[model samples]
Target: MYMALIELKDVSKLYGFGDATSVALEEVNLAIEQGECVAVMGPSGSGKSTLMNIIGLLDRPTHGDYYLSGKHVSRLGANQRARTRRDRIGFIFQSFNLLPRLTALENVALPLLYKGRSPAKRTRKAWDMLERVGLGDRVFYYPRQLSGGQTQSVAIARALVNDPQLIIADEPTGSLDSNSSRLVMELLSEIHKTGNTVVFVTHNPELTRYATRVVYMQDGAIKYDEQTKLGEVGRYARQVMYAVPETTEEDDLAGVSAIMPVLDKRGVAADKKTKLPRRKSTSHKKRKVLKK
Candidate 1:
């Protein structure tokens, strides 16, 4: 494999200090090669999203070094990092972070504007990107006017409009219904086939099977990084029985046990809606902690 476009070497990110500190990641090393799609799977609070944010330049680590596209960014200042972000990285989220008022074309054009591109050229490029994502006819629609799948398509177009070297996605499908999720995954697979590096953090292994490589995570570290290649010829069929018992539990989540990484926010609501027994929601208010 080629030298990673994003390399994490013995990275560590800690919150708070010795007496009250929590380790998010510890000596975690990873290399994401160009043109490969690697899925990071873990549950809420497992530091998987922490790794994603660090890799995406949204946050920094407490220790260790990181090299993105050959530049050591661990020690870079905020401005330098911001410029690097605008120039090299593209992000997609499960929530479909599209501006509510901007049409699909305008939404896609926003990133190029930050890069100092002129309106005329950026619009043309954005229109092309929308068409590429199969949203040509919907370019004039606002976010609320589009379906969940279409909104995600717009978000994907926005992420690609800048032509960044790496696409960092966190739970890109966690917001959609099953059908919408399938469509988004198919679109993502097509985008990967177009030759660009992708590192997506998701809890969905059904989608991970489409990745060229899989990075299974647990307790904030990669447990199994295996090569995965599924046929694109047809979909994976699910056998179901209507008479089957309905329950809140499924074996799929067993894979994510004890890993609590990020909320995978889009799915958080649906998961709550399922009427399953789950942990009670907690407010942002922090409780007082006395010294041990």
Candidate 2:
């Protein structure tokens, strides 16, 4: 059986109380296995961000059980949740959330400071992560000095610097232009290839082409969930063609071949591709720290 990296059972989130209450999520159940790249798409007010926040441990479900790598965390106290967020999850935001005063390296290293790493060690690891994200030369550059894409890349490096098992990205490409969006998507694909579970919220259906599974939400509940053969050029081509307005048959056919070549005649199956190696769980450490 595949080990689930994230499991939400009848999860719900609400704002306010009694009649004034607003339901942001309604008994949502989801299981994301290790190494799966899941795209969560929905219209505004459909609870995509709420779900991301809940899953990222930034907020607790109003009611339900949340298991992250088999540990029940839905009821964890604020400090415990914060530690879990720091130790086990990496978050990417559409705004690229870098500290304006900090250079790329400093921003990336910020997370490690809480872990009590020496400054030199933090710098070394942050620098290595920046290099991994193709921003090694931009280490000393401030956010103001970077393009939108570069800023997002730095954010990604910061997210990965802690080597978190799960990456939660909220509309990561929403603010980028077409080319930058494509670049960010490609980078996300590379991250998924490294056996990390990635769950992202996106409005752009085109971006779902890169996902192994797509979850659609409506009215604060899951509307559809389906797995697809990613890495199949035809799949993305078909999605793009459908999204384009008033394309002719000739254009559709030509677009398919020109867009992205099929990497595998038989696309890698999710079951096979996502059989990630098990890692030690840090729940105990987090709990101990929280108890202190």
Top candidate, metric lDDT? 2
Off by over 4 Å in 1: 232-292
Worst 10 residues of 1 by lDDT: 234-243
Checking candidate 1 for backbone clashes, the offending pairs are 43-260, 43-261, 44-260, 44-261, 45-260, 45-261, 46-260, 46-261
Model 2 residue runs over 4 Å out of place are 1-3, 232-292
lDDT of 1 by residue, 26-64 (tens): 888998878988877766667888898999898998999
Models, CA RMSD each? 10.9, 13.2
lDDT of each: 0.73, 0.78
TM-score of 1: 0.79
For model 1, the local distance difference test gives 0.73
Cα error, candidate 2, residue 71 (Å): 0.7
Error of 1 at 114 (Å): 0.9
Q: Backbone clashes per model, in order? A: 8, 0
